[model samples]
Target chain A: MPINSKIVRRIGDLARIDLSITDVDMFSEQLGEIVDLMNQLDGVDTSSVQEMDSEIGNGHENRPKDIVNEGNCIELILKNAPETKEGFFTVKKVIE
Target chain B: MSDLASLTISKARDLLSTGEVSALELTEHYLQRIESSRNLNTFCFTATELALEKAKSCDRLMSSTDRGKLCGIPLAVKDIFCTQSLPTQAASKILEGFVPPYESTVTERLWKENAVLLGKLNMDEFAMGSSNETSVYGPAINPWQDPNEATPLSPGGSSGGSAAAVAADLCLAALGTDTGGSIRQPAAFNGVVGIKPTYGRCSRWGIIAFASSLDQAGPITKTVRDSAILLEIISGHDKKDSTSVRCEVPNFEAALNGDIRGKKIGIPKEYRIDDTPAEIIKLWEIGINQLSDSGAEIVDVSLPHTKYSLPTYYVLAPAEASSNLARYDGVKYGYRATLKDDEGINELYKRTRSEGFGDEVKRRIMVGTYVLSAGFYEAYYQKALKVRSLIKRDFREVFSKGVSAILTPTTPSPAFPLGSKNKKSPVEMYLNDIFTVPANLAGLPAVSIPTGITEKGLPLGLQIIGPAWEEANVLNIAHRLEKDSNFRIKPKQWWTS
Candidate 1:
């Protein structure tokens, strides 16, 4: 099935990236075939196969202990931010 | 040591231990080489000042018996690895001029071993492309060019810079991360050694995340033993990455005793697809005979789900990449787009991300978001995960039946001319990673060692994959094959002149 241009635009919005009309047209054509290729997975019967998360091996033994820890570099942490004011990240106001 | 620039880690070690060559002298030689070979565009950033200072320190420690194995050696770091106070852009406009205040665990360990930083090497934008064409800074040209045409051949990627630097002899060895065949495929194209150790073997702390599950760090070097030496230094447990396995690091170099006698090497029949080139199949057969001649028991194995690896990798890698790349908002680190009067927070995010990401990256994020969206999640993303399990089970069954390693071609064919393939869409590009994805999906160790040069006089690679955390056996098999094949096809030094 053709992945509709509307679906592509929705995905682009979901990903929070703006797309020109040209990109939507081009990407929808490409993504449609890629998603169709990915649909090949449906042919394989995986009824009893347990999903593997690479190294995790379907187990949670590697999870670190939960504890609060302080990082040493607050100034450095704020160093790369585009807008920082009074030691807090600043962004455009969400509420009027 | 007349030709200082071409020395390997093991060769350089022998000379350094005997006080034949000072570390400072070695660093200066490589710095000069990096500058002279500027035409290749292999090195995106280099630090002569920092390298010399560290080389002096390395020289001072040479007198002590407690010196580390990599003491006084110079290495190129991929831009994807965070080096404290140095630019680590991953060759993307989004991360242009972004310097981390801390070091990646892998790089920190290399520095602790007294390895000199030769500066950051070029790569695909966020490690995304099979060819190096997608890099924002421009492609890192493969040192090997076809004889007749001026058109540059690709070095393969996203570790293209690492491979080109090693093949060009810019550094002794380099570190590279492979999410899906980045290390191995690039190494194959460049005629060198590249290995991607099992996932959880190297800590992911400070390394830029492309795909969290498949991304792994390993070494790219000139020889198999050099790869073993570097791998031994870089692989181990780390508290910083929780997924890092807490096991004792093995002596990988010592394990390369050239002893693969009575070992079962699997040749997956599924790897021989109909469309695969005869030359590549011939090299695979040669690799089989070479190993079998060395007393390894060659067994025909079947990974029935092998054909679906590339499609599954595309789904899973992108899904994770969409999540990992979400942090790059204009409010945080790296490049931020200029806002217009009407733009608010949502607009800022949309514009910043749209401006920051390249075409390929944008394509992936959209594909990823589509799969994870509410309606299609069950049909695509969930289905891909289940298929991944079957691919892993294929390896488990073969390995459990006493197969020490699986031998196959590292890439479908030798290096094609850059821009010759992948002109229309990414399907042809993604297909290039077919043979090398199963090892990543299974979290197993895989290496690409040059087997022979092609009819076009380009390098080809044979891959050896071992079960999880059994890099020792895999390295041993590759080491034996290296000696048996004795395929030493070096690129003509056209770029250096």
Candidate 2:
């Protein structure tokens, strides 16, 4: 049940999140407890079960062609951008 | 005046058509009520200018008799949906100032029907908690409260604000999304009818993704008929949402009055949990008895997979949600938490996300990540999904065996007090969705109707779930029960009281 600092750091890395030692320790215990709770699913027999990737799979047969931003209110969408400039959202350089 | 508070869409439409009340007047009435009841926390944000503008347009359309089904009806949208002009924060600080430039398909459809927009109702942050307590704006107060209790009771979450707004007569009805009982639970808590349509019936585009696979936007309304009309307007296919169905969307409003004279209603034996309160059990029995007396056959059906639904939902929903919510990395759309010196972009994302999401959401995200991890994928996430299929198959088998619909209590108990946080253990809190989560897992349509009240006088709801796309059948039975029960239960004490 004790999620040590190391495991927390690994989890933080996996999730692409940075955690302070204090947060790492606190989240470790909390996440550990939640995992312990989720461990209850171990007893459930899912031998014949097929994983549910999507909840509703009935409607894809006649789906329209992938509408890339089709009929979308462009101005409305841009309003969501916190740093849009000239219809493009500006972001810090990732590769540089 | 058509008593703005008690007006149904059908009535409002007829009156509006006859020039009884302008859309502007109806919008103003509700806005005034919202202003007075600001302390109720029923709404997160109100777009008065936008609403007035839209109402004027609706009035202009009415002059030309351009009345669509939801024409002139002012709808209070749940904060979960994105609006172009409004801040679409899911009652969370992470997305505090984030405004979605796009509109959710449901909201867009409402606008197409000339439905006047009222405002956004508050909700639990990211639709995680039951009590709406986790919301950054604070928990919404139930319109009704016990005399002994001075503090506001929880209006049930994630859709607590939507339910409270309708129950308090702030708006005709509102949109709410149900992912693991979000809509139905709050409807039960606030004594309103909430329907979570069969998955894929309504488009999920524009609604903030909670549990992608399980989430469906439905109407939380005062009457089953109102919910049906709202469903008719909102339920349809959109090219925007890949998951939307191409099947013929039924005329739900016309089907509302259909005869349920001899339908077979299944009583899932597993729904009667041992921990359910005696009063709730009694209420369930009364509902069953009422259905039976009305010429519906009550058959004991076994959904053997029922017990596994909550756990399956917990695993599956979090797994999907963790993936869906990965888009909100501060830089793209939402709030960015500035990292300390020496920290880079990765650290900023980590800090922002960790700080942004609340405990329950974080816990789910972690579980989701853990389950979807390479080593654990096959064992956990994949395994839970398989159980999910079996659960859906169980409902199909029951409905196939001459059962038109399944009946059960929405929650194990009535609304707990707002701060009754420590009363139930986490597992117990998870069990609150035991009855409702199965319908979502199966992608079947279901509704929660206020069938009865507990001995202590809090409202208890009975959920009626039907096979996929059988929304009409479910609403018919619910309407029949609504009339038969005649519970006439209102909030115990209004805000003024």
Candidate 3:
């Protein structure tokens, strides 16, 4: 799992973080080292082990009744938005 | 009044009850201390007016029969926890100016207990780095320095400010989150007490999520008893966070009876890695002897999967962080990059994240994205999950063998100079969490108590880890160690000068 500049670029795109050529080269080298460190897991035999997704394994199914417990404060919800129009969070046009 | 800043929460509570010190007087003393100690860079935001208001209200209720447990105690929290109408930036540029409209459940609980807030402490951006250098506000310097040497040392990180502020007596205690070793490591570095309870002991709702499963809010305090008092207030089930366990919050402070008789304290041989400084090993031996002299039987145990904890944590935490951080695009809250007219939504996300995130945060996001990508998910993320299960099973085996708690050195070495390690490689910095990450993987309760000092006069800590939901047992063992070790060393208050 050698991370090259091309793979770093792809990862940057997937993560939606813009990276320059210098960042790509630097990340390729650094992430290569981190990946090498993570490669230690390949040596351990996990065949018989169950994958522990959450520390508290049994609590996922616990859900409260479906109801709108709290809402209706549009001002509070949009308070921190970078831009808001007509009480909705405004982003660059998704489709023009 | 100046000496009021040195009192622990327990002592302060007694003083408040006896009418010897009003809550307003205590709050004013800490506010003055925080104002004078600005050079340490511990507090990013100081809510002086709000703290005075809260303290006045607390003084009004001083004679009431029903009062909160932490009624007059002044404390600060890592900026990662949301404080409603106050700045809750997570110490990252991306979250700049993002004041959360609602309080985090943990902080809400603290308020319900009538604790005074001295505002938010600084931390690594998104709690990613081992040193506090990644904070947008700059690194929080450790108060402890070699008296002969002028070079400042690091307050081991992520929760660096929380630990440093408590060490410097800027606040009585501070709340810090431990995802890997964010709480314990800094506590070790600053020569204070910190505890990370079982994973679901405290609610995660309204906390700026780092790694959801691993992130837990705990207290960094001047004493083990203060840690227990704060932990009791913050622990319990909350409807807002489903992961918060539905269990009884024990009387943790009351459990500190200093009785460890017949308790089997485990010393896992696997923690003894080569190249560890002789001071750390020697401090660990002193801890073992202290516990043994206190009548607790020391047993040799094996947690063989311990070595894989750091690798597993690195894989899982970032994969979750990459997903959690995806919400910080330009659309909603926080910083948004200025875009050219032709740019669209994707460009908005890219530029905003690139400009907003720090280097270590970006590096983690990259590793997380790469690992969770289409082809590498099973090899990295899935394999790490199984190794996590093995690590949990290893702890379970030891605890099942009647081991009451496991004692280990909290960090590999004492605090170093601020910029010394992270320069060469990020992996060098990652090794600082080696001794503390295993408990997070297993989701157990662990505490760090300052028990020894390095030859350079920097403090070293010994960690006591207990079974899941057994924070009471863990605190009791630590309280015993704290009593036996009698560590009373405080950092020189050079910052105030």
All DockQ scores: 0.69, 0.47, 0.74
Per-model TM-score, in order, reads 0.98, 0.94, 0.98
For each candidate, the alpha-carbon lDDT, in order, equals 0.89, 0.83, 0.92
Residue range with the least summed lDDT across 10 consecutive positions in model 1 chain B: B416-425
The residue-level lDDT of candidate 3 at B363 comes to 92
User: Least accurate stretch of 10 residues (summed lDDT) in model 3 chain A?
Assistant: A56-65
Q: Write the per-residue lDDT of candidate 2 for residues B213-316, one digit (tens) a residue.
A: 88999999999989998998888887788888877988887887747878999998898788889988888899999988888989999999888787788778
Rank list by lDDT: 3, 1, 2
Where does the lowest 10-residue lDDT sum fall in candidate 3 chain B? Answer: B418-427
DockQ score of candidate 2?
A: 0.47
lDDT over C-alpha atoms for residue B90 of model 2? 93
**Residue A89 of candidate 3: its Cα lDDT?**
93
True contacts kept of each: 0.76, 0.50, 0.84
lDDT of 1 by residue, B368-429 (tens): 88888898887888888889888888899999999999999999978878788855578989
* Candidate 1 chain A lDDT trough over 10 residues, lowest sum: A51-60
State which candidate has the highest lDDT.
3
Which of the predicted structures, 1 or 2, would earn the higher lDDT when compared with the native?
1
